[model samples]
Target chain A: MIAAMTNANPNIRLDKRDLILTKGSEVMLRRGYHGTGVQEIVQAAGIPKGSFYHYFASKEDFAVHALEFLYAPRLQRYAQALGDRSLSPCQRILTFYGELLNHFRRQERPQYHCFIGSLSFEMAEPSQPIGLQVESILQRSVDILAQCLTEAREAGELNAATDCVELAEFIANAWEGTLMRMKAGANAAPLSVFLHQLERLLTPSP
Target chain B: MIAAMTNANPNIRLDKRDLILTKGSEVMLRRGYHGTGVQEIVQAAGIPKGSFYHYFASKEDFAVHALEFLYAPRLQRYAQALGDRSLSPCQRILTFYGELLNHFRRQERPQYHCFIGSLSFEMAEPSQPIGLQVESILQRSVDILAQCLTEAREAGELNAATDCVELAEFIANAWEGTLMRMKAGANAAPLSVFLHQLERLLTPSP
Candidate 1:
């Protein structure tokens, strides 16, 4: 995504902005907002402190843009995963979460839960605008799933009475919680349970 | 609980430690671990800076104890709620979550999701001991729910095929995720969806 963005926009200014956001997101996600400092972000980005100020007025402002930068690709992925036509809509939704759980299992150390979920948890400092942006990203994710669920029901894969929108919201929220547990490290594999329960949820009982 | 603790312990030293934890947990939950400072916690607890150090070796140590203080009451409440015989085992499990959702709805602002969930998300700093402690607390919570689920299945409330342990884990993870969404503020009420889905999962469809 970064390469494509720079290729599409030859502007040095936009390229530098993207560089800072990409590097800034990495640092922020690892260290969290307060744990990170302005100097740390600039150092990580290899940008001058002046350049950082030029792009973002404040750390909070940087976070908003960084979140926007982080979410764009993630939301795109969610749409891609759920909207994949090769799999039936039910499989697409189920497989999407299943694959994510696999990715979590492969991690060497406990990685952060979904960055956006962590950010929302850490965002107790009360930035209204940032809160609004996070809310929008969360909705977009749920909507992407909702679309696939709508397809599943239309295809007779799901029961006719299922509320696609509500199911989408529940799945999205549950998936976030699953990610939360993935980091906390439970005695039993939450994803296996999540996938098992999800299969039960999507498939009718005999 | 605090009242009971104080009544049981007449030691002045223990009383001071309890006061610090009570006040410290309140601040930590509201402001978060990194957001809060030792001095601020001292002020909140009305103890001297020297006294704060007397109780805890470091901020991280303070957080661990605070988490313990925080979880004790919460786990107690969970055990009490799930063990209440006035409700059937199925209703005990389902209604515990439903009531929690209603409580979330009553919140004036986006209160933090369960503190443990938030800390696990925020705990990206690689505190192995803290991580293990959180994991154990999570398991204890799951076990409490699992015991209730086992009873439900034994009482013929849930399907015979139900895996109570797995279901308990999934519900705990999903509920944590549901709380994550609760703070994010989605278009739909997650708790209602969570409750709706929980009902379906617990009660077999004819």
Candidate 2:
């Protein structure tokens, strides 16, 4: 059936897949993993219901791919910012978070949240496959941030005595917490405060 | 029908209600709002499907009450801790979080998360009644924390220049984020780090 459908719309197969993934990411981000249905995703993507099954095997399968779709570009951007040698390692970290806060600010919704943080809370159960996927993605992000912090410590841009790994974990966790609160409070004030405090906390005093 | 069902088990009315709410809170915390079914909640509670409907009108109604059921006692406990005059205001703040961290440490499941945080992420849409309930409960907690910070500031335990409201918001958000990370990482390290960092962040310079 999938082959038949793909054959019928060969030119649009790739585009349709992208469309589904993009729409899935948006709906899942807003409604959460359990709240969104495949039908809703198809409707939002403006594709036939049969097209959904053609592209993805199951909702869980779709969710895993949707998460990948959502995070891939963001991860690339994160790497670009963190790996920018033109900026000091510490400045790279700060600039990365600053850009994130700006992105959150530009969102039209009063309640802004992180897709990974939200999904992690909603689906990070031992019994759930998506939970494990979320855990891996989160760990990967923390690892990247830890690398940046280690570089900062080596460059004397951060406190030499600080545990960069632990600090990185704290930063990642704190920022995720800040996003959760931002959504709860229905404002960006928490994001702003987190950014300001994070910069101060990471900066060593003279 | 609900009234008849309640009258049928008049003496156990309150007990059964508590049972359902407790089980509902647990399932909702683990599975999320839309992810959990009414049947699952009833099964977990060992109550009949009829009993669930007898106690609550609908899933959203049940959720609102379940949130109240979960937060009310915690709020009282929080007040008791924060209002402990024997402890310095700063000590009270630290003690509350310390106990919370210990509680998180005691959970058997690696993916244990906050009920309020999970619900807020899953159901905190402006259009949803449950969202409003969650927002109100969260705001109340922040208000309580803010009050504690206010006391600390007045006692010179915290910096006078710090905005207690904003700091309280940050603390709440950061802690929520930390819980999300803790679940994702399957450990209590984030909770410990959050506590340590929060204390340091809030403490006035010598």
Task: State every prediction's TM-score relative to the real structure.
Answer: 0.90, 0.81
* Fnat for candidate 1 (0 to 1): 0.57
DockQ value for model 2: 0.49
Tens digits of per-residue lDDT, candidate 1, B105-190, equal: 77666465356865777773467656677888888999999999999989899878888899898888888877777776632277
> Among all windows of ten consecutive residues in candidate 1 chain B, which has the lowest summed lDDT?
B1-10
Candidate 1 — number of clashing residue pairs?
1
Per-residue lDDT tens digits for candidate 1, residues A81-116, read: 888899999999888878877776776664653567
Error of 2 at B87 (Å): 2.5
lDDT score at residue A130, model 2, on the 0-100 scale: 72
Question: Per-residue lDDT of B1-206 in model 2, one digit per residue for the tens?
Answer: 46546586665787788889988888877667777889989999998899899889988899889889888898888888999999998899898889878987887764455777777777776436777777788788889999999999999988789789878877877777777777776788788988888777777865
User: Lowest-lDDT window of 10 residues in candidate 2 chain B?
Assistant: B1-10
Runs of candidate 1 exceeding 4 Å displacement: A1-10, A108-110, A186-188, B1-10, B186-188
Q: What TM-score does prediction 2 earn?
A: 0.81
DockQ of 1: 0.56
